[model samples]
Target chain A: MSQHARGQRPEAAPFTERTPRVVAARHLTRRQGRDKAGRFLVEGAQAVREALAWQGGQVHELFVTETAAERNPELLQEASNAGIRISEVTDKAADSLSETVTPQGLIAVCDAVPQPLDTALQGTPRLVAVLYGVSDPGNAGTVTRVADAAGADAVIFASDTVDPHNGKCVRASTGSLFHLPIARSRDAAEVFAACRTAGLRLVAADGYAKQDLVEASAKGELKQPTAWVFGSEAHGLPDDVVASLDTSLKVPLYGAAESLNLATAAAVCLYASARDQRS
Target chain B: MSQHARGQRPEAAPFTERTPRVVAARHLTRRQGRDKAGRFLVEGAQAVREALAWQGGQVHELFVTETAAERNPELLQEASNAGIRISEVTDKAADSLSETVTPQGLIAVCDAVPQPLDTALQGTPRLVAVLYGVSDPGNAGTVTRVADAAGADAVIFASDTVDPHNGKCVRASTGSLFHLPIARSRDAAEVFAACRTAGLRLVAADGYAKQDLVEASAKGELKQPTAWVFGSEAHGLPDDVVASLDTSLKVPLYGAAESLNLATAAAVCLYASARDQRS
Candidate 1:
């Protein structure tokens, strides 16, 4: 046995898996992970740390390269302190485990379903962001970060969007994913129904909408418990979702470019509502 | 000599040693050929199409692989129609010329500093996006696309920002860069001063700010000719700039996330102003 294997305490057993079956099970493609394991990979030191801090129980295992463990002894210490398992592997193993070219040498396998929507929506629950077919993981992650920063009640990803568990998305959120409530719904209508039951008004963001977001917010049209819906740049929101919304709001483009990126549109809409509720 | 060379028609130029040198000069990284010659590179069928559409007189030579010419006959015809010189290169040569992993196998060499900014910003420009020290080329490109969609008068890159002509940025913009007026300023203060003189309000975006964006814009605070200033996510707008701005606005953070991505923040700010102006 290696020195690490011999020195490994009982707490590390859950995390240190050398069997090919266990190792293979841990590696999941975005689609397979989302469907089968209901888990996603979160990489980078800061992101993994955030997950450890905020959602410790949800993290399945902690993977760290020997070099990374040497560099960040505190992380290992924290895992041990939290009663979380730790696995140390070679840099090559870590690289294969990572999504990005330059992995931060740390990664976490976490539950994909996240926490329950009700738990996330608890409290006053004044503001929320509803993502409709946001196809890019980075954009989706950014929306989560913005939602967390804006103190949104929750961020719901509707069906047909990119897998939120994609590595790029986790890094883009800058560790905000740990603190943010993200629920995945296969049906947009069902997600909307939940928001409606929660007493949230749906505000759809569309470039061609006649009502400007500022105007709509100022008129108290979006003042109630609200869910801001942002769509992909390629295809705006699905027709049915747009039709079912309480109001369609536009950001008001003055240039020749046709549309703003999906995440940017969401931030603008969410911030508008945040401003209205605060005042 | 080939038929193309023999014809001396506007359509063709036989492949020669000079052709590679001409096509290579357009990129900033290529120290040899045109980049060394202070030229710039334009790549891909779409970018090349836009270059043709713009009637960009700076185009020196065009490089096309046999496959590219076969696949995009219209692109070659368009170049030929414009009386531009065209050369057929080997697949290996085309691969070497491409910046992306999958080269479209088409590229153009054009004079650097295609068109001066003073000429582009001739009229009373109403909106502008000022990027300060945003180092990511992809972010810069996305910002440009958002600015264009917002109908901003121009997009300015402050010192230390990534080069606008980067291949990744150009691709990310989805050809919006061709339509947008992108200017570079070594001194941010000078750019801000110019905008101020031009009667544009300087709205600096920072995570920590006294006023919310909606309130600021609704109060006609950022309605007029305006320059939206965004900085890198790591270090936000410089203190000096923020202090000097007409107003500093923040997107309220309701969640625990510290900040939104730079491009997202800029889009939110720009769109807020767009909403106010439209209403």
Candidate 2:
């Protein structure tokens, strides 16, 4: 074992608000900087812990405040043992690296967490979520978390969806972002075709669809491999997109609600498929 | 019928930002003001419309800007026909009444929405949602919407649960607030007892439950009338609260997610009851 204790003492000089590296990390809050740098910032202890545990994730650096360092000593020790550069920072510097009102005082610079669609769907994907035009970062991240909970194989973000690396999305995901494979594409049609070729039936969660979850379940359509496609909450899947799918089914609204939230609908559809497929 | 023309002409002088009535209406945004006045503000067109439609709701006043009036002439006419007071207000006055960044140019003051717990759980209720200490307005409201969508008979806001009349909660409910019965109480045990007396079984969605949804389903537990009790997402049902419930079952997590969001889990649980009961 190495003689020097890891994460035993804070860095001799903690990073200040004016630190250039900390300043650079702040830009990851925006999409342009994240895309160009091929990296993003993961804030809060839970997400940072997930990033550190994910074998495929490259957590290059960790920024922590004195209070946070004490609060999460085990996580810091883990990061130190993994050879990740641990930088001590002042509260102001921690604030600079966070987008939330109350920063959890921990952040990690990670490689973008997405891979190619083909790579994500390589094997037989029994349950997958394809978010098309899901622009809300919170909804997108919530869906990612829901998909993971449903035992989904992968989540494909296609065509104008919010960047999965967005801070709000990551926070809303509550560490589920790092738990599963994520893939992105600009061409939604190609993504749908790829899903079909992978032997997963495309089922869009359309609000206006004639068939509901019960009917789909009755027909035994939900038991098969399915890639559940969801669109924006404001606008359901585009007519052209819905037309191209194998079929579309609506989450039944038994009461007076006109429609379900995008994440809510996705949870219902994905869990339905999960229940039937597992049964 | 003798009126010159309904909603055809704007008031001679629209209420200014400093108008006393407009100033008074803004106070409804706060809990203290809302509680003191026994009234709350419902913003946006959809909610205002729902308030207009609800037989139980008394839409006391309607505030509208010129632009919104022009856009929704029919809604104004409907309000006019309903004998509700229509107050034309300046854009500045409308802005003063809204909490959202983009005001929908419509706001309605209505009576507080909660009723007695016994009244909410009245009748042979097949399904219901009991939110205990769910303080997040968004989560509580979304659960209310989900409960409505699943055709639950009522939603009981138990104990320290957020006031369902909170502006964010009302907006998040997307007008479902007016579609169903809502009950509130400071005593959670009373709420549980009332639910049990109503012939509804209490099922808590616990993350650490040894019994999963599959086992619960296989045991024919879900087929009966049930009141699904959910707690806050951050801290689940308190130990004492969970211990008092009939039984607790967790949504089976097929993937790596630690837990589902409160609303997501509620949707899955409520819809499961809907499925079995309907079948």
Candidate 3:
């Protein structure tokens, strides 16, 4: 409501199944278009609402169904105030734009907002999560949301990690993808070098490690400025990567489970650091 | 090596795309057939291996492609020594039985082994993870694996929770579904009664809770016999359901993320109890 004095806004465009704009928005379904256009699409009410709340100006346009618009006119009105183009699209169009079997009927076309890894590492970071060789978009996205929830300064994806702009990744992140600065490094070595240059201690989340995560934090191991490297779910951290870190810590598995899934393990490690630093 | 003393097995039947037995196994793909036959299909090499190791004779049949059997003849040979039926299936048949987009070329039909809630609660349980209204099979399964990793004595799925025998759930459990005793309850009241009778304290993992999970465990709050309740991703524990619990705990959030995901939150809570009890 701060800058909404732009007064009365024009009505939304008529519902259309296909238009030049709709065609362009649909093109965001691919990585090539996303990179070329420097834009990505976020679907559903929660994500669109979060975009308006945080990155209002960056939201280029919003597409909604009649039902969605009627149910949440506030969302459209807010976007209109921020100069975001608003339009209505057919349910079929919404379904075509969605990855899920059932589409949520609201999509926000927004400018890509990923921060450069160098920029995110320039200042002292109290906590950071580096994803190395994480190929699953869902896992990568959840980790991004978790890093934000755990109060990490940023989430850095090594060159090999899945694109955070992937629709599935955006969906999995819920709304938190926009809440934090997502950074990217050329590789793990670059991540290590940057963390070292920024005075952040590097710690790897290794399931095979003897050091217990909670115990290590309790013993002041995670009290320093930290960067937690989470590896691929299948192979874990590379041997050289783990050896180069300050120390690798594991969440203790007391029963028959081989290890916690990647996202959960990341949550435990990041929260441990959050608690250790906050305490 | 230990089991081959049973001697040379009969020659395997010729690979086929469809047969009476294959049809029956395919029917097991649905819940009605599974309940009727008291069996479910476990696919992929990892799941089948774990099924053999944990459930042993319960694995009724081994269906594999020639490639799978040739690549891992020892697996089929072990099944043979165990007196389990070993049938080679055509690659197309294997594909037909698989639920995943890219089938891993192995499937095992196994007996259901869930224990009753009362039976699981008969003995003193050091830790438990309860799914009160969890609807997603994937989340339920991961929580089961997480609980097992945290050394919970058992995992209880209340009425209306997704079936633990569901194929996706089984896959997500990574065979921890067999590693721990899985119990089914009549409802929330039955779960509460059973937990009370067992002298187990109840804790619900709520994203909205004010009580911090890490702090609570650090204070010896989780040291006593505990049962942690996890709810659905869409609708968390019912208000009445949560009100009946001893307390609800949340993982502290230091940043802008609204909350931790269902699986990750469950993992953090269960692992907290695990660490506390061990200490």
Best by TM-score: 2
Across B74-184, the per-residue lDDT of candidate 1 in tens digits comes to: 777777777888777666666666678888878887655424446445578788888889888889889888888777878888868877777777777766777767777
Model 3, TM vs. native: 0.92
Q: Candidate 2 — which pairs collide?
A: none
lDDT (10s digit) by residue, model 1, range A1-279: 234432434333323345463476355645775568777667777777787777524777776766677666677777767776677665666666777878776777777745566665566678888878888888888888888877787888787877777777777888877776777776888888888878888888887788876667668876778888888878888777788998888875566565677777777778777777876
For each candidate, the alpha-carbon lDDT, in order, equals: 0.73, 0.89, 0.82
**Ranked by DockQ, top first:** 2, 3, 1
DockQ result, candidate 1: 0.63
> Ranking under lDDT, best-scoring first?
2, 3, 1
Query: Model 3, residue B106: what's the lDDT?
Result: 86
Off by over 4 Å in 1: A1-25, A28-39, A55-57, A113-126, A207-220, A238-249, B1-39, B55-62, B65-80, B86-91, B111-123, B201-203, B210-215, B238-248, B277-279
> Which portions of model 2 show Cα errors greater than 4 Å?
A1-11, B1-11
Please write out the lDDT profile of model 3 over residues A53-140, one tens digit for every residue.
8652388888877666776667778887788877777788787677776788888898876776778776778999999999999999
Residue B32, candidate 2: alpha-carbon lDDT: 90
Give a tens-digit lDDT track for model 2, residues A1-279: 011322454447788978898988888878999999999999988899899888766999998887888788788889888888888888999998888999988999999989888888998888999999999999999999999999999999999999999899999898888888899999998898889889999998999899998899988999999999999988878999999999999999999999889888888999999999988
Report the Cα lDDT for candidate 2.
Answer: 0.89
